[model samples]
Target: VVGAGPAGMTAAYYAALKGHAVTVFDMMEKQGGIARYGIPEYRLPKVKLDKELNSVWQLRDTEFKGGKMLGRDFSIDDLFTQGYDAVFLGLGAWRSNELRVPGEDLPGVIEAINYLRMNSEGNPVPVGKGQKVVVIGGGFTTFDCARTSRRLGADVTVVYRRSRKEMGAHYSEVDDAEHEGIRLEFFAAPVRFVEKNGRVGGVEFQRMALGEPDASGRRRPVPVEGSNFVIECDTAIPAIGQVPNLDFFEREQGVRKTKRETVITNGALMTDRPGVFAGGDVQMGARTVIECVAQGKLAAKAIDRYLAGDDMARVAEEIAEEEAVPELIDIVPYKPEEPQVRMPMLPFKERDLSFQLIENGYDKNAAEKEAARCLQCVCPDVGRCHLQRLSLEHGLTDNRFHRAEPVDYHDYEYDFSHDFILRDLNKCINCTQCVRICRDVIGANCYGLMGGGYDSIVTTPWNVSLKYTDCVSCGACAETCPTGALMMRERDLQTYELDIVRCIYCGDCVEVCPHGALGETPNFELSTYGRFGRTVLAKEELAVARTWKPSEEIPLDGHNSPRPPEIRPPGPPRWGD
Candidate 1:
């Protein structure tokens, strides 16, 4: 791994997981590349970022070497000669694109990436208090520059050549910027930077009109003749775009670059060289952190295969197959609509000359409520569906029986009344696997063939809900059904009681859960009898109780005789009656 940004770190982490000795190198003194140096602290805190990067280093056979430039410090051949089998370059686009207009080289004309990097390194540029800052372009970096300047008590104006709809920055960022007293000027292209005493004093722009759609599918900005205008300012920051700095290697290195200055790679993320690979912003240009992480994962898989002496071309084909998106069927699952959870942010009034964190994040209740809105339409047994596997094995296609009259086939209403199980009778083939398993094997006897003749179907007694039957929620019926007529609900519906005695306190469950439902109480140390003698962990018992027993007496044998009743956690209401 050549760059320690999101992509490089992710690649190193996955590569280390494969039992390979991985070494991650970055040009900066720190591990996180752009995420640490280019992005402002308000957006992503350095402490949290460092914690994640440190975990990657903790992985087996992995080490991070900072202040090491790839092409400058060591070449691909150098790595190979040093006993390394393969190399991955997750380099970033640190070079900011410039505006071609004259006077752009003035003293106060700052590059957005350079400014952000400087601020991150604690040597912020002289952009504070009573200065007018003109930010050119409309992207995430552009807004970052504008917002950072705003926080520094400077009057910031974002100048974009295109209209609002074509602006690259997210709408939320733009809205927040506007709320923080930043001005926005659209459909204006920079003509020249106005100089004042050998420094940038203002910017001259020409009015533009939206023309036909360009290759990017957005209407191009066409310059309107003689419509020149000037916006007075003390600083000029052009955040037009970013491109990778490929000066480290020449063309003979077998790693090719495009005209846009991004690295060129095959489907397997390998360069022309057999053992060299590139990914992230170095290959895809400036993109989201998630996209960079995805590419890093792909590069790790390809590098593993390369090191294992597998065919590179075959690996590329396999990667392409895995990446291919499957066509979705035309079935829409029924799901109730819920409003999105609103993020809390610092008030605009308190933002003056302050870089304090914005977007306070969701609380435990809000996060769970938001997560519960997932439709979960994708069947859990999709790839493992017995019916699907059999159909493919026999090369089956359309059902010829569907060509018969509408009365020949039955369409039954789905039964989702059960708390833990979902029943879609329309998908049932009357296989009786559920009936036999329920009656003969598990002995739940919850299902049977109901109705008569053509109307006969496999269901609970008298077509009642599974909950009303002798169903034990053993999941044997769902496991035995070949078709998707029966299935276990994928969501974690029930609130669970943590057995303090059995819990190892690894905190893995708390860390890995997407929804913030589970939380650690402050006094888990009192859970064991070793801390305080007489099994005095009253909180665990009272956690689930409907009424408190102030006068309850302990058995003193440490077992407590009877356990406390299980109670559901507060908020994000449960589904079952």
Candidate 2:
């Protein structure tokens, strides 16, 4: 892999996972590409980023060589000769696009990427305190330059030809920059840098208006007639965008690139040149980090297939099959609305003149809460479900209960009312474990055996939803179910408890529990003494209450005495009579 950006790192990880000898090389001293150097510390902290990247190093037979230039250190031909089977080119875009106006070559005109890179590396250039800095462009890089300059105590101003609504940068980031004291000027394009004594003193801009949609499907900016203006600034930074730096290699170097300078690849992520693969910003022409990661993953699979001498056609089909999005059913699961966790940050006053890393990542509690809200997007007890396992074991290809006539079978709607539990009537086997557990163990008597014999089923009382029941959403009934009838869904932080013996829904003491608040832990335990004075309550008893207890007076000579009274608490609230 060439370049250690998100794509390169992902490709290396997946390729190495498939038992391949992988080597990643980059020209920078650090492994991460733009994420480490181009992005500001406030957005992505290096420590967390490094911890993730360190995993790539831990992979067996995977090597990362920092400060190794592609053409200078070794060419593609050299890699083949060096006995490597294949090569991946994730060379990210490094060169900033030129502003192309007159006086742009003057001193104090900074290229956005290089300026941000320098600042990220702790090497301050011309920008400093009391300097009036004007940045050109309206994207992530533009805001990075403007905000970074503002952090350095420079009176920073951003000029964009398009409206703020049409900006390439995320709206939150643009708003953040505004909140950080960076001035914004829209509908203006840079004309030229105003020079004083051969150094930049200000910038001249032309007013623009929205024109017809361009090739990018966005409204093109048209220059307004005679609407030129000037803003005085000590420094000028043009952050238009960046393209892949392909200076070392030529057009006829076997690999091919589009007119926009992005490498054109086959469906399998392979360049025109055999055994050489390209992905990330170099191939996609400066896209988001997530997009780069997907391309990287795709390229890794393609490279693996190519190395194994598999047919490219089959490989393309398999790649497409994997990448194809699964068709979602129209029934959207109604998940409770929860606000996203806001990342903590330093106050605006503290941010000035200090790059002391901004975003304080989520602590354990915050992370757990945030993670519990994942919708799971999947069933928690999928593999371990005894019902699913038994069905597979018995070769249950078709449901014998699903009758041809609609009236022959009851199609009861799903009960998603309970916050942390999902009740699917189709999967219920009428074992009465949920009814018994809810009444006996949890005391949240939310369920009962309902209806006549032929049409009988277990559900919330009066068949009128669980919201009206005494269910606390403790997930005890769910944890006790023998099948997928009652499933404990994800619920962060909001938890309930149960005891063993009477809680026959589960044969074990501790269950994985719902998603959010906590994992299923034995918060409710009943300690009992055996014949030899050993606490023998075990895992199965962990889920139930003691149905049979020892007598108050201990009979020493192994006499199996009469059973003690069943200690029962008041049952869960009653909704119906």
Q: Please, what is the TM-score per model? A: 0.68, 0.66
lDDT of 2 by residue, 169-265 (tens): 9998898888889999999998888889879989999999999999999899999999999999989999999999887767236887787888888
**So what's the TM-score on candidate 1?**
0.68
* Clash pairs detected, candidate 1: none
Top candidate by TM-score: 1
Give stretches of model 2 more than 4 Å off.
Answer: 251-253, 362-369, 379-577
Write the residue-wise lDDT of candidate 1 on 1-577 in tens digits.
7899989998987776556789988889888888988788888898889877776765456787888887678888888899888899999889999888899999999999999998889996878899899999999999999999998889999999999988999999999999999999999999999998989889999999999999999998999999999999998999998989988668337888899988889999999988999999999999988899999988988998899899999898766754453543533446657889888888888877888888788877998888888766445445445455556668886684453787677777888888778999887878787887667544457889987676779988877889888776657678656666899876644467878766644344553332344566765422323322333445555353425343665224345465432232343323441
What are the RMSDs of all candidates, in order?
A: 11.9, 14.2
Mark the 10 consecutive residues where model 1 has the least summed lDDT. Answer: 525-534
